[model samples]
Target: MSGWTWADVDVAVPRPGSGLPGVAMAGFRQRVRGDVEIAMVAHPSVTLFLDLSETGGIVREAGGTSRRGSFVAGLLPGRLRTGGQEGSGLQIRLSPAVASVVLGAAAELTGTVATLEEVWGRDAGRLEERLRDAPTWDERFTIATDVLARRLAVPSRVEPEVAQAWRRTQAARGRLRIDGLAEEVGWSRQRLWSRFRAQLGLTPKRAAQLVRFDHAAHLLAAGHPPAAVAGRSGYADQSHLHRQARAITGLTPAALATAPWLAIDTVAWLAAPRT
Candidate 1:
């Protein structure tokens, strides 16, 4: 059996066609794992993350943080580093509409640190603790929503071009081809990649890979063979899937498959709009 330790609850509602969007729920504890390395998590949506105090990383509002045995940096758009496994919290997935506005506003944020005193009504550490202790999901979401609302006073003005492109990407369901995606978006490859990086923390290719990896992980957990998972997830083949899995998560498919703590709850409440 895999010795890795991790657990998570997906409270967000599943999007039609796409299983989950605009948010993701997760919790993990790296007891004996190697420094719990997580590949850069990049998505089109602006991610509002709550890192419980057990986590610690230097955050560059744009670059990213590398600390502890693990490294988590706030890539483009927005990110929160409240700190480790003890720092379990929610990741508020930002729709492109929400992302545009917040990114614009955050461009003017004074310092490197993600400020919370004024907007969140308190600091991140305390908020993390509060959420952890909250008796019910509703109470936790309420606090989460309150924090976002206060910081994002203005809702995003939707960008049809970007939004449509994002939809098309989703339609491909993690099996998107970067070259085709760029063409479909009507932008040159370089331009699309640049825009994707600016708006989201990852290049289009990286994002797709993550989606595929996540899918494969889920499939493996469901008892699918690596070869089948690879084919289903649009990988070149089983070998490709194995390499990608190790590259992205620092764990092999078989390793993750047998891990004792990989089971994560997939529930809608986890995705409910933050309070």
Candidate 2:
């Protein structure tokens, strides 16, 4: 079981259809006969996991810190990992734009993985208990989305200008110039950088690059060549794409294209079919 990966598990992605805005939740539950360690590759969104395991809870290791309970992972997690025996949980992804409220502040979670208790306080346990007691996966999804919707209803969204800039960055797949975005948003470069980082837990440049890599990674997974992906993903060339792939995932572009972390996303998100 040391070779465990998302490909080996049965993932259930019951959709909420239209209720959840800017939030995605996927439920994963499976048992490995023996010990297993899984490498969780980085992604572009803030992630939260709700644990309901009857046995061992999931453990996560990132950077120099590690935790073994229900948790939230910030953007650009560098080589996070966890596994063993068997486990069950709900994984939720939140766009940084709406995360500021649903999560209290994305900046607080940036680049780090923390126990849900740390981020959600007393409410974390309550949520977990409620989810655990639920009779069905659909119920958990409903409970989880309802919780986030309640938080979002309280107001305190990101600035409209900053949100627009982020949307543009995603639309361009990180190819747009920082200064250009600042000009269009009417904020100085310095101001944009500060506010963006403070609210999203990532600088504009980093966010753009993350979005770019996400697009390219999926392209590669869909069987596109690196050279072609580089051309369309806004990189200078193939070599540039290779370096970014290594920097972000510690894997060459080819290997990252088939990486299991990304493969499962295809199944769970299912917005795009495999080519």
Candidate 3:
């Protein structure tokens, strides 16, 4: 076995035509000769991490709790960290809208980390076993996608209006007003606020902020200046962007620009075809 490095890790994604809407899957494997640690930033999606390693599997910590091996991380899992002596897994990112239907408890998962068994019970173990026995990353992706597709076939509990609101928010890059979303969705402000929070685990305003911050973080990672990123990301100004960045990631703009976590996005996410 060789030392672990992001560059040496094998990364795999599903075939382009096989994708489910609002869902993305990636498979990773590497030999670890020493300890490994990664600071994971918050993203807008609910994430499922399946650790397939037979020994020294990944351990995740957030919100004063720790989970080892496979787990589910909801949106805005603040200041999350993962460390271990082994690294091999399938990671699935599900949009909150789809997560509501698939996980069937997206609201309960908000801002927290829960074991896969806690979410899926015995099924979690079965899925992990199947993935571990797979001969290739491609096979694992196929298996994972098949399982997700089956789960998605169940009737969605999320209202169409709420899903539409989320779509509009993403399309606008969080620049639109919550009241406007309510109006577009044919619901009153109060109604929309309550329902959206109940289903997605965050208020509309916070969702917008997360989306905007995500945009700014990527731009910062892309070598843009903080002022330019803030303006481009719809922030009131650089100061506002700084505050939001600190609140979400606990890092200044300059420091965030070079974060190894965001840096990995270029290779593990952006480089892969969406599926």
- Reference-based TM-score of each model: 0.59, 0.91, 0.94
Best by lDDT: 3
Q: Worst lDDT window (10 residues) for model 3?
A: 266-275
TM-score order of candidates, top first? 3, 2, 1
The residue ranges of model 1 lying beyond 4 angstroms of the native Cα positions read 1-21, 24-135, 150-159, 260-262, 265-275
The collision pairs in model 3 are none
Candidate 3 per-residue lDDT over residues 89-139, each given as its tens digit: 888889998888778899999988889889999999999999999998888
Q: Please provide the root mean square deviation of candidate 3 (C-alpha atoms, Å).
A: 2.5
What's each prediction's clash count?
16, 0, 0
Which 10 consecutive positions of candidate 1 have the poorest summed lDDT?
69-78
- Rank candidates, lDDT, best first: 3, 2, 1
Predicted candidate 2 versus true structure: per-residue lDDT over 46-71, tens digit per residue: 88877787654777777766667788
Q: Once model 2 is optimally superposed onto the true structure by TM-score, how far is the C-alpha of residue 123 displaced, in angstroms?
A: 1.1
- Whole-model lDDT values for every prediction: 0.50, 0.80, 0.84
The worst-scoring run of ten residues by lDDT in candidate 2 lies at: 266-275
